[model samples]
Target: MQMIKQKVGARVRELRNQKGLSQEKLALAADIDRTYIASVESGKRNISIVNLEKLIIALDTSFAEFFEGM
Candidate 1:
């Protein structure tokens, strides 16, 4: 589970970077807290499904795409 969280976090960070979005910007887009986003990206948050959906939507990606290689 910890490894899964880390992988998800890494994927989020990768997509965020690819989209040229800062953590603050991504948080704003997702309507989530910036610090929360930071924690999530740092693999310190076991993000809920609702919040994960929010992030995925904000990242302009589908779940299939988000978890493509995972």
Candidate 2:
């Protein structure tokens, strides 16, 4: 159950890479820290709902859309 966040994080990372966006770029677009994004991608951070929304928006996706294949 808790692994869902990690999965979501991984999916986000995959999509970001697929779109040719660096962690720093995504963080800048999302108004978040690059380290934070790195942590999430590495499954080292348990993101808050707020931060999750920031990532979703940065990826230009909805939560449901972002999580569809996750």
lDDT: which candidate is best?
1
My TM-score estimates for the predictions, one after another, are 0.97, 0.88
Residue-level lDDT of model 2, residues 1-70, one tens digit each, is 6797688678989889888999999999999999989989988788888999998888888888886866
Clashing pairs in 2: none
* Tens-digit lDDT string for candidate 1 (1-70): 4798889899999999999999999999999999999999899999999999999999999999999988
Among all windows of 10 consecutive residues in model 1, the one with the lowest summed lDDT is: 1-10
Model 1, CA-based lDDT: 0.95
Alpha carbon lDDT of each predicted model: 0.95, 0.87
Look at candidate 1 and tell me the lDDT of residue 69. Answer: 82
